[model samples]
Target: MPRHVAIIMDGNGRWAKQRHLPRAMGHRRGVEAVREIVRAAGDMGLEALTLYAFSSENWKRPAQEVGDLMGLLKHFIVADIDEFVENGVRLKVIGRYRELAPDIVALIDDAVARTSENSRTTLAVALNYGAQDELVRATSAIAARVAEGSLAPADIDTDAFADALDTADMPPLDLLIRTSGEQRLSNFLLWQCAYAELWFTDTLWPDFSRAHFAQALAEYAARERRFGGR
Candidate 1:
């Protein structure tokens, strides 16, 4: 019953390596996992699911690989948008979307618009996102407001600062899952995950099944989240 769950879909490259398949093939397969997870989350009555689709540092990868990733994104949008709209699933693309290719940006805008009124579920895809960069950007916005006399420096607090972050509209993060047995956050939703339960698994992104997701939720359900209290 996590109100909001975020996942770092890791191990695409490693999965590809293990199978002697091209890296792009792994990325393509990862999209199938995304579809499965989104469906599972909605069926489970989850409020929101935020996926770390691409990070800011991912641009450091090879040009062909990046191109392949973008191509896969485009393919997913085109192939699944109709189903998303029909199922009442809202699609949100967060992070530096303006930096993407114009066509991709247009597709994202279209998908978001088409599902704007959906209430069944919310699926947020974080592309070109970085936690530190998001924090810096939020701080800069708050500073600008203070300098403009629209806000007082003394009024800044955790809630006020969180409002400046990108996830202000979404529910507070309740669970964070990292696949491929990774245990690090990797610059994803740092502000929102302050109190989220953490889960890790060795299943690669392409291999992550609904059973694995259910197991993560089961483990989360067994925890006692007292916030700061004992």
Candidate 2:
């Protein structure tokens, strides 16, 4: 079974356009999909699930859309906290969290703390995160340690760098699913998904159902991952 599944949620705007609904409504519906997937993942006994909620490039979107997303996240934070606790999902946020609005950031912290004791599954939300940004941040932190004389440059490698990133504590990713028929990575998990099996589907984010999730899982199980070696 795929223990850790990472998702690149795509095609919300397209979904809205297809329905003649405003883009904001699409985001709202996507929240429902998020809810369903989390429950489905819990039922499936997934050890960890990481979602690419917002990427660095997402900031370039229209101001109104961005504001709507923030509002939705705030609502989600409040609405899901209890559900997370009840379902034994440990909530964790990974990325440039300081970039979020102060209130939203506080809510994220509160939810994480409240669900910290849960042991069923770890739900990691990647907000304001970009793969290249993560790499740069990790490299800078490591370099600073070397400058302070506590770390040696020669002693640093993949293990040292991995510990500096936000998802350091998590296990290697097994499967990654991107909806909306998107075949490109779009700079999601640069380091952690080094060997993960990729599954892409045309279903929009709001339309991604439990069966869609199952299909992705099945696809992942069929792949023969060589991890860069034959």
Give the TM-scores of the predictions, in the order they appear.
Answer: 0.98, 0.97
Worst ten-residue run, lDDT, model 1? 90-99
Instruction: Name the top lDDT candidate.
Output: 1
> Distance (Å) between predicted and true CA of 227, model 1?
0.9
- Please report how far candidate 1 places residue 26 from its true position, in Å: 0.6
lDDT of 1 by residue, 1-230 (tens): 78899999999999999999999989989999999999999999998999999999999999999999999999999999999998889998889887999999999999999999999899999998999999999999999999999999899999889999888889999999999988999989988888899999999999999999999999999999988777
Q: Tens-digit lDDT track for model 2 on 1-230?
A: 79999999998999999999999999999999999999999999899999999998899999999999999999999988998999899999988987889999899999999999999999999999999999999999999999999899999988999999989878789999999998988998888878888898999999999999999898888888898898
Candidate 1 TM-score versus the reference? 0.98
C-alpha local distance difference test of each model: 0.94, 0.92
Please state the error at residue 201 of candidate 2 in Å.
Answer: 0.5
